[model samples]
Target chain A: MTTTARPIRRRSAFMRNAFPYFMLAPAVIFLLGITLYPGIYALYRSTMTGKFKLEFVGLQNYRELIVDSTFWESLYNTLLVGSLTLAIEFVIAMTMAALVYRDPWVKAWRIVFLLPMLLMPSAVSYIWKLLFNDGRIISDLLGKLGSTLGNIDFMSSTSLARMVLVITDVWQWTPFLFIIFVAGLQGMDKEVEEAARLDGATWPKIFFNISLPLLRPVIAIALVLRGVDILTMFTPVHVITQGSPAGHTETVSYFIYRTAFKSFEQGYASAASVLVLIATIILSQTLVRRFFRSGTEA
Target chain B: MNAIRKLTLSLWAIICALPIIWFASIALRPHNEIIAPQPIYFPTFTTETWAKIFAEWPIMNYFKNSLLAVSGSVFICLLLGIPAAYALARYKFKGREDIGFYILSTKMMAPAAVAIPMFVLFGHFHLLDTVWALMLAYAAMNMSIVVWIIRSYMMEIPHEIEDAARTDGASDLRILWSIIIPMCMPGIITAAVIAAIFAMNEYLFTLIIASQHAYPLSVALANFSGGSDGIIYNAIALVAFMAFFPVLLLVILIQNHLSRGLTMGAVKG
Candidate 1:
């Protein structure tokens, strides 16, 4: 019995060493096929030019991208829209979360607030598109209020069109931040806040001194996740504005899509996509490191 | 202070509910009333648009297609994710943390960065315009969150049970099947549900890969507008409502797990 057990133990030891890799292999291979391989292929394609025929061009696409006004405009539009939407979402979501985080009775609001996010983004964009249509809900409401503003097309003006994009994004995503912040608040240790309160701290004071600092990691995670998403900013532009008014409303994602599919400029679009990808990696990597570092320290 | 809190919550709730209410109101209005010269604030609510959309469009077919694609994607994600998650959670191998971060960083990539090449690859494989393409794309897109969430759940399980099983001469795989899987069933279900939501809501990939045969509800809804006459607001609204209703219900059901799932378990709800 002892001799038999010894061989089995040896075999099992070999198995234990091999097991984790065996379990991870299928997933890793699949992920590589879908993400890494495609990403690398895209990088390769960005340097070559052709329409149904391929010829290598060294950095020509990137060089042209430098002088492309449309590319620059799309980048500018993406930054403008993305920053505005993030700023509004952060303020609204943080305020709302702070207001209701302590209330046990407002649990239903959580589900209600989550409704906007559940809708397919395409559907959400369409809903807003209809509401903002000529003589539609928003326009009609404005007309009823005796404002001449309702008579003009919201999509025809650059500012109004960009505003529509911002409004749509804010409406859909603020709930995401709100829910995360509420969870962060609830999961925090309450003793610090209670101690501060007993030390004659006001609610606002306790919140500022005790709660906010502890919540830094959570805030960082939420903002970075949401910021990464808003950086892409595609569907509303596609469904509602279609980057109209001389392309003032075109975000980077939409610009890439239009270039790749609409004009069939595959190599050129790939270059723009690579630029966006690099920027995102740099931006998110910094924030993610900061978040994890704070998380470990706390 | 309490009054202000209550007031704030109530106001936000109304603000939250208003757009949906407006959508429903438009959905139930008659087409004539919708297109009337003056905005019909109090048109008699009718199911005519809903009925018309159902009768004309193969709504159920798109519904079935969406269900098939999303469920197929979630199944593949779980099949791949669970073992990887368990390995990362329980094993102390070299570079395990790096491997986990590698998996996560894939999610940070913009879909645009990969879409053209993938489209070309699918064209080569003749996988374009098929449910298979959508399923594969969704699985890839959702892999990171699914793996991390499941890993977090696995980490919560006491390691002593597996240790005891090991001493009893049970193989690791067998122990995982019989012990860990049942114990982490809630986490598995949460991951599946979240993956399904993202898969179902996916539009850009579906739009690129699927044109006719594999059109999910998202792409189908997008194509519903701009008929012969003009934009059909009521029909569009009805289809949009149907597109969202399933995910909306699923989200409400899984409200407690969302924050963790959304943040990939970085911050537990």
Candidate 2:
């Protein structure tokens, strides 16, 4: 690894000064090998036929995606789940983070909030699946909550199943939002808040006018991260409903998974992946600009 | 006001502890007493569930696979990630912004999208179901994070040390090993902890690559609980307990990094 290389002494002092450029060579190589190629390759595959004819299909794959029913359903479900999860999580998580941000008594709540985050999402899904299967322990307990709760199949209702998934996702991940929000709040310039308080600004006014604006950058970042996260979520629906009772719970990721693996339609899957990737990039860029144009960094 | 806050904390502790305590007790309790309606708070001890966990299933194999894949990624991340991150941090060069964006963009990538291409790659290499395949996928997925976290930390280190080292006869790699690596230990540990936990808890990639013999503990544990059929409550609870134990211990041991990963910048173990 430490084999000697030719020095840049032959060049002017300016060019020679950049000799350390060689040090950066490997990282760029690895990044290109792993990311740039795959990203570009996905786009390339998206434009080709899957039957191995390798014929160029061009934008037809994009057209098929527009008309693809499963793609639409999955896309709709992804959006629905993302929006619902985000709105609910932000409110609850913000409240929780504010409450626990610097509290000495928060040691336990912090653990409780983060416990599910530690478990693999797939594991969390299975646990919840076991806990909420129609005749499972939770349903059995809810049986006493009311007869309807016991009688109904929790995973059967398209709306209810989606709701459960959204709720489970919120339960498992609210800690992530809480932790970030808490850090954002804790890291704020306390002197600014103290100055506002000396001016006798009401707490609500001070929070709305002061704390939240400072938190916008982080909250936007949290939103983008969580939005993409919930959008691509798969394990829960896979374990809990198997996208079942109907096709209601399958997200775009699962749709892509089944298309590629189950149907052996690699071209179609590639196209779908390209579309999802494009959507994600566009959404991410918009959110990035929204939160970071005035700032910088991903 | 103070009393109210105390009451809230006390209440929340019970809420949090209830599920964890209940799960732990479930693992230790014998089969017959598990379903009793009265609920056995203190049960007679037996080697029953733990012994059954080992004897009846392939958890030990899963355990081994998880450790190997996780540790393998940690080693790879340290070997390859540190030097690269240091360069990006200290050196300002053309395409640096693009390179950083390119690295982070991978963090947002959906595992499902990569599943097919990576699986096809594994097939081409005949690596399916082998630990190597899982390790390769993990290394690829975690490369972005390993770079990002390490770079951020590396930026904080003074360049004067590197300049001083360059003034000596010391080679670049030697400077890295002797000067940089030791100084960046805390940051390296933070990044390693994040990557190791990710590798340890990762399921989707393992599901695609690792089958019965090669499966990680999480995937195997899920299958153990029940798949198409419903779960056997007692047995599933025991498996859940088993699954949580190692991870819970890791979080406690590396509480700071664990919190840092969850939070924005810093928190403590």
DockQ list for all candidates:
0.57, 0.35
DockQ measured for candidate 2: 0.35
> What are the models' TM-scores?
0.95, 0.86
* Candidate 2 ranges with C-alpha deviation above 4 Å: A1-22, A40-62, A146-148, A284-298, B1-47, B168-171, B225-243, B257-269
Between which residue pairs do clashes occur in model 1? none
> Which candidate wins on lDDT?
1
| Candidate 2 collision pairs | B255-B269, B256-B268, B256-B269
Candidate 1 chain B: worst-modelled 10 consecutive residues by lDDT = B224-233
For model 1, state the Cα shift of residue B232 in Å: 2.1
Give the interface RMSD of each candidate: 2.9, 4.8
Highest DockQ: give the candidate number. Answer: 1
